[model samples]
Target: MGVQRLKGKIKLISVFIVCLIITVFPVVTHAMRGDCGYEGGISSGEAPNKSSFEYQEVCFITGEPIVFKGTLKIKKTYKNNIINTTYIYNLDNAEKKATLTRTLNYRTEITEKDNGQITEKTYFQKDPYEVIKIDNVTYTLKNYDFTRSSFIDQKPSINFYSGDIWNKKTYQTGGVNSGRSTVTVEATGNFYGYDQYWGSAETQIINYVISSESVKNGKIDKWTGTAKVTLSLTTTKQLKYEENLPEQSSYKGVYMEKQYNESILEYSCKLPEFDSKGVSTDIIKTKSGSLKIETFPQSQPLSVPDISHLRGHWAENDIRILYSLEIFKGDSSIFNPEQYISRAEFVSAIVEAAKEVPKDPAFEKKNTRTAAARKKKEEEVISPFIDVSTKSEYFASINAAYDRGIVSGDGGRFRPNEPITLADALVILVRSVGLEGMAPGKYPVTTFRDNDLIPYYARQAAFVAQEIGLVKGDTRGYLNPNEKLTKARAAALINNFINYMREGIKKVYTEGIVNYN
Candidate 1:
């Protein structure tokens, strides 16, 4: 709390929840010409975590490159079918030229309809807005209304949304009223969350009318301006196992995600001369910076997860890691590591590992609440599979996977009790990671020995999984795509998938920024 307040500008740092890309220097390296990164660890907290970051960007409002620092504090509380998040920012540019203090309060509501996907709508509240000052201009908030909506199945794919915003502001220079602007914005954007890291980018069309202090001939003197705005927000959350902070534990050392949002508003606008009173000129502004904060761990494993039966097993370590991370769980002492995993089990584990599980509805008031407030939550989804009962133990997970597009029922029946085939399992895993789109429309023969045996539906998934190092041939050099997946093999593959997200995907993100030349 104390260290984060020192950052200098509001025009410099912004939100991570509405973020885009994860391109920055690695921690411990010198700040590069066009990048900035941090080297420290996180602090423990009850809810919203706290952290800060620095970056080098072409200033969106100043039209010049500047190094900037910022701090973002975010707190979330769950309430009836919605998660309300509070974003607090303390921003400062490196040169001490600009600063901003603001709080953004927003709520994302998830409504589980009869459809197969989760529909989310985000709403922002207006009140107690802070001032945003950049150099000579001070932007005082007057009114704001913004909303975004999207649908996601439990995968790492992009969260696409279309939104509309109307924001009113009054500006003053040297404490004197300069103008008032009504800014209208339309946008379609998306957030892509890879495991351990996430990003979102938005390019918006904004039009604003700047009204002067006087009116001429019964008309208020105003100038209409339009611009193209692009904001690139980058961040990746990693669990620190090698840090000097809190020691790693099943109940501690897990870290929440961070956000670094850079706003770059650049366009060519020509002001028209009226009565020869204004000079015709082109104006452009490109201010960019990001705000990222790290908070303490908030989630822990459900229980010790009796891995006693996994002793000397090949997938022992993998299973242990997943259990520690709360990504997978097991039954009692009779751990069947070599047994075939059911479709329901595979889908549930895959979704949980991807971290796309939606929250249940908020608790109702003790007193009789309104019907809307008490709308059903425990029964999150009505099973699309005729074979899956609402009372089945796997009902929630199976329904969730269906909603996320991770799995599908055949002829309206989900064979929950049947073993999941390797081909089917690979498809689910590949889909969960959001790389299924890389599969070519005209498929090529796979390089595996059993290429001829690879099922049609699993061909793409096999290709993608193999390319990403998530799959390798067996001792006999066979993919065995048609075989049922054993719990042991499933754990190994799932662990590999997690590693790919933590290390392989990260390699791409980091190396791309450093070697873009």
Candidate 2:
């Protein structure tokens, strides 16, 4: 009777164990399925919620193309066995999106060669979808479920532990006009693995094998065996943001953060190799490739520097105007209006005015000068004066004036600190206005009583200076060309030059006539 009770107890225990297995299997299977979609159990439903609308625009103003071409040769060695795989990809036809603030449109072509067969595929982006059209059949792909599909997808989920499995899916439309065509992907990977190809602790390495298939109308369109993929992630040094406003210098310490993903896909059969291309068909086209994200500061009203001695002076307005334009920086806020200006100071002021001020009112819209053009001009001019060192502040300006034949040195000595005479000032002013060669070989005669006092070399320059209203004699009508140029007179002369250039005055001088309008 005891033996019979033992057998019955064993049967009851077996029945209970069977019931537990039946009940818990489905629950475990469902939990595993939930974790299969993404690297960190991230589901496809979670993607749209994480999509960012706060995009920074990058415009290519010149419409220059961005080209990417590479050939990936992957070799895997285990014991005495070696496997080699080659993947060739080319991305081109990338141009500025005219309608979008910071967008690019491009096409990508990928080729895989293995087992003596070559397979080629091309992809492009249409609004809200990635389309691959081949032989009059369009395969539209939507809802990319993977973080890293290709280079076009800037973000990819690479943070996963060893022995993790994930699944991805993309919905397809067009081609065959049947039920939904779906591409299903299953990947198993070991993240945090070490590989020599990637090197160092600076990179995150992932080794994975993925299987993918496309089903159309309940039939398989294509399928693939396990494809080995080795991927590495390296965070590069941040790139600086360039601003379009010329006056606002770039903030050197600020940079945009970027992550670079390098991956190699090795497969012997057809497998889906694309995520979303990040190409937006709805783009804003602009004539400028540069993106303007912030409001730029406008030029404020000119501030007149205080010069106490110039109060109620005859040349006060001229001094204020030149100072407002930043052409004349008075020493210690004292203009010293009666002090004579040196030759070096005069040339430096002329160069600064030419670069900072616009040639005409119409040109004022372009407020910034071209830095590249200025540097090029500086490089083209070599200093011929022994007194001017390359490190001198006025070296470039003096060299530039000399290159244009506007100013010449005396016996190879610049005499930069020497006071400039009225005759020499006239020559420099006339040449600055594009009238260097317009002077006649001989002037008929001047009514000034002091014409004989003017040197022979400055005769024509003196005549042109008077004709252009750039200079005027004293009340006695005596042209004192030999007198040293004072700070106030220099300011007035430069102000007149500014007016001449801004007014767009054109001058035509015949044998004996001067016509200007």
Candidate 3:
């Protein structure tokens, strides 16, 4: 019995050893696989027992032609105690240059440490690579096309001034001097294809039209001027505000999708002419400069004002006159005043204002000052003659006034709606009926005793108003002749003249010289 028991114990020991080998064998194999195996030429005895991983490099240019071929390794794990291990080697034979570079990383993990639950994952990424072709031509990662070629071919700027272009009307008292000049330049090359490169130009041109005789020492005795410029893609190209450039290219090709620059320039000036009393006066002022304008198309949020009373009050008069003349036709039924007013619209408004105060018959019919008044009014329409070309809508009005002798212009210039002064109006009014011979003492001269402000040339003619009873002096007997004439004042002055003419007709009727209707 003792011999049989010892034999049983030995058998049990053998079984325990066999179980231990089965449980530990896989763990050892897996641990070996986790380590990196060094590779080198070696004898069979030194060679690694397990398969080793191999790596090689592949490269490509961004926008060139080339080919790439490579091998990818893959390994499969066993599951459910089955010997299901598999290995794969992937290779591609397709011929194509790489537009981008990519990097791949792989990882395998035993998620459940208690069990042999092997999981493998892969990741991919790309990076830029420089390439040199077999022809020894180097290419970068980014490429450009024909559209970019056009912009890149342009050269840097070279600025120069252009001569003035003069526009004239008549020779006598109808000429206006215009100093219209320009600046020309070429755009810089390499402006295209740059991911973040942008270009812009800001320019201004100022002008002064002075009396030929007034130029003594580079200074004009009396002068007037105005300025304007072509704007953006409509005229210029490659526009940017006084702001920083963005990272990516915000522009496309020049033809259809490319953006152009904005050019902003302005000018203003006055004229030298006579007042109602025939006094020479200088009237011109200006604020001329340039700006960089940008355009953005986005819906603007509506703003609710705290106070609504001021809504229509701001542009009331301008709106009324503009609407009456059909100058302010709203777009989509909404008036957007912040929008830039066009030159056509501005000129239209001036024509409307002139129409509002048409030449009166009382001023036109009288033989005394009719010819002179007609001449002066005609002159006003013809000054700065550039304003009225045959194609211009203002041509008819300008020519009509010229024919009626309602105005007279400078040498050949017709300054339309440049802003009129009190003296300018008087010059037109005085010539209407030939008031040259009227005496200063006939009317109430006491009313306008203080006529010192009247320019020497116009004093005598101004006194004629007193002589003709057209004006009774204010309490101070003074006339502010030099003050700028307001719209209301101009109207009042016209009414007064009309009344004067009517009184003269009444006197004639009382004497029975003229028959009453």
Identify the candidate with maximal lDDT. 1
Those runs of model 2 whose alpha carbons end farther than 4 Å from true positions after fitting are 1-300, 330-332, 354-382, 442-444, 504-517
Better of 1 and 3 by lDDT: 1
- Give Cα-based local distance difference scores for all models: 0.51, 0.40, 0.30
lDDT digits (tens) for residues 157-261 of candidate 2: 111112232334343544555544444334444333211111111111222233223443355544332333322221111122333455564321222322222
What's the TM for model 2? 0.37
The residue-level lDDT of candidate 2 at 190 comes to: 36
Per-prediction TM-score to the true structure, in the order listed: 0.53, 0.37, 0.24
Give per-residue CA lDDT, model 1, range 375-400, as digits (tens).
Answer: 53432334566677766777668767
Q: What TM-score quantifies how close candidate 3 is to the native fold?
A: 0.24
